[model samples]
Target: MRIISKIKTPGALKSSTSNLLGRFRHDDDGAMSYVAVTGALIMMVFGGIGIDMIHAELKRNKVQNTLDRAVLAAANMDNTMDPEFVVQEYFRAMNMSDALSGVSVDQSLNYKRVTADGNATMPSNFMSLLGVDTLQASGSATAEHGLTKIEISLVLDVSGSMGGNKIVQLRDAAKGFVDLMLPADGSDMVSISVIPYNATVNLGDTVSQYFTLDDVHDYSSCATFETNDFTSTAVDPSTELGRLGHFDPYNSSTSGGEIAKPWCATGQTSAVIAHSSDADVLKAHIDTLNAGGNTAIDLGMKWGAALLDPAARPAVQALSVAGFVAPEHSSRPAAYADSETLKFVVVMTDGQNTTQYDLKPEFKFGMSEVWVDTRGTNTLNDDRFAFRVQDNAGDDSDVYYWLGNSGQGYAMKYQNRPESSAISNGVEPYQMTNAELYSRFSIAAVASEFYYPAYVDGFLTYDDYANAYYGYQATVNGSQADTNLSTVCDSARDNGVVVYAIGVEAPQAGLDAMQDCASSVAHYFDVSGDDLNDTFSSIARSLQMLRLTQ
Candidate 1:
């Protein structure tokens, strides 16, 4: 229809065209409508362009505000800042009432990924007639804080239970931890300690300088059993407590129970792997460790104290023939001091203290009656609390706490007595019986009498079993355990050491141990088997950060 109209108007258009051409050729002053209409069209187009540009500038300002705020927030995370809180506050700061208050922020780790959704509402001028009332704009930005150096101790449990798929899991977890601590490319970052503790930790060959091994310790001289004297001089070897727990039918041992075998490495040793160096070597070592022997947590922990210990480095050099300590620049204290170095012991065990040695015992069997005394095991240290009452099933009623004083559980078993310290005149019993129980005795007298009972057990001496096989002397409270732990922790703290505790499939006893050792409850990790990796990584990161950074 438009084409037919143009064709029909051709004759009329020729007359109009001639007039328009004559005016343009002369640049005529009289004809002004054409110029006015053309100018109006140009202005209309430019008005829309101006509106678009203004919208773009506003969007750009919003993006800049988000980027600036997010970057500053990321930087503040290094001061032990909470990332979540920082993200929330930063975005809030970027959003303002007069400006973009509806800005949204997405946070992760230490950085904020921000997006600016420009206003969906705008006051349109010339463009509004095109059926557009508002224009939308958007942009994105990222910010992050600088991380510092870290020192971490990766104390792992390489005990018997960690066999099977567990070890494989450990390898993967350990590698992950290392990867996390390492700087992305080049940064003087973190250091790690891989301590694998079983019955005894193997500090490897570095031990001779710091330890005296079992060969030097006579197994027979370790400690002795009960008071009764047997008619035959030779007792069954089966009843003997091993130097290390007698090897289980599963453990490598001629006898079933090897008393206390060495748990810590013979020297100032710890886990072997790539430490502060390459990853594959350390991971390989972790993979290679076999879960073996009894769990000598105390010994393993003490050795853990040594490997990261600066004091032991000097001693390692003294035993050069073994070639355990390399005489290199890295071994120097200064070399170590500059880098963030962490010492950690992640000990996990499903057992309790089994091996207690260094005492003696003497027992005599009299016709159907067993009379027991100490030939070994106890040594007299006035400071060491000796259990005044013996609490075997037959004797619990006769013991001290059964009568009273349950909270003061850590009784010093006189450490120096050659014979049973319990019955010795120098050793007194804890008279638990109160004065109320004693008609003639005053409260003071009764308290003194039972709290320090004169009638001691002859077997309670320097030479007795630390404890009998499955003979659990009830710990009235966590007193004894706490004292032992407190002594170690305070000493370490005095020396500026940070002690961490891990409860890995641990019993209440183990939990107490970790609590006793940890600087605070937050530093302790109570975990089931699967959570071990998470716990390990958390510890590794903490230790790494503690050492590597300010």
Candidate 2:
């Protein structure tokens, strides 16, 4: 009895231990309890902060990428605004859709900085337990057009063959280009040197010091209509080529022995075309043009280059962009910073090269009527070209290769003409043979006269003959005599001139050349038979597109 009482019962001891454990679990007491509660709360707060910061960082990164892309797009500044709108809109959409909103592009100019900014609000994922609801993120981007400058030269073909529709289209397009290049705002920065061409460009007395007998071929003197007033009476005053017969600048007596008709038809045609910067003057010149002349594209290009030579305008150089610079840029090193101004060239042509082969009158007795074998090929074969020999009258009698199926027989070659009328008197040689005989004349459209020889055999198919005629006149051996116009263009590019080529109604080779000459293949445009306004507008659109991209 005494031992049991002293040891205390096992049940009692167990009850005591259980009570202590329950108290420990239920009571908030002591330093350990305080430490546990504080640690958990701290962790929750930190987790919320971490999640918010991560989301904010992501939003900022996204905004940065979009702004970078948009700025780059603006830097390329060309004539088109569509691309710029598309680029800026895309980023704006992304910003609005994502946690971000209020993204926008401000001041997108070629030479100026393009800027973009955006902001975002995102919910905190892990921090919700700590009462933290959201976080904010923002970003910005900016870019600038480079300091490269440029010099532009325009080598345009205004040959006699470009008379009708082609000339009209060119006048409209060229003027549009000038308007585009004109300073949209500010004192004009870009400089232009205009070269209006024919067999020779007319520099006028102001630049006549550059002209001399050396510039003329054959006659020892260029036949100025003013110098030969008596013979120029038949010339019309409304046409550009015809303008030669009169003189500009009113004088009691003008250049021609005859009193000048106040103004020559073509004299002001490109009126003040090359010499002035005023839009009104350019407009007047554009109004006066009437196409007429043999093509001398080489001479035209050469003179165009001369206008932009750095040595010519030391001061204007600072206003020019160094290279790859166009009209739309916002800032650049001064043009006068270098020896030359920013330079470039846009060469355009409709008809191919043509040399006056022969202007000899048909009335000469026993004289062989000149015939040009217009069967020129793109592929140069020595044997086919071996017989080419041009005489003083620009006549090439020897046949190299023919490009046709001969029509009926020899008799059909010479069609009906009254034989008694005499071939020497410029009678239609084919008509002299027989009334019923259908004839085939090569290049009949452009050539003034057609001749059929006595010993001729079968005739060629009319279709083949026509192609050979016109094709030859416009290709390798034609008015634009060189198949390698691109070589010259590329050379010009290396010398600081950006080359823009337009292949309007062009052949494959011509297109290829244009692609190579353009700043890029995308810069090249092919315009076939189409509306003039639309064609010019298409070109304008392209120019704008290029500005936006590059």
Instruction: Please give the CA lDDT of all the candidate structures.
Output: 0.43, 0.43
lDDT of each residue in 1-550, candidate 2, tens digit only: 4655467589999998999988887875662576788998898788767867887888777776776676566545542454446456757677554533433444333344455555667787766666777767776665544222443455666666667787778777767765655434522444445666665455443332222322212111112322222211121212222112111122232111122221212233332123234445454566566666555454455445544443333212322333222334223222334543455666666544444222111221122222222123222121010111112344433232111112445333332222211333342222111101101222231121222121123233454334323322211234243433444555556665556666667556546656766767655667753544465555443333222221
- Give a tens-digit lDDT track for model 1, residues 395-414: 33433222222343434332
Write down the worst ten-residue block by lDDT for model 1. Answer: 361-370
- TM accuracy, model 2: 0.45
lDDT of 1 at 529: 65
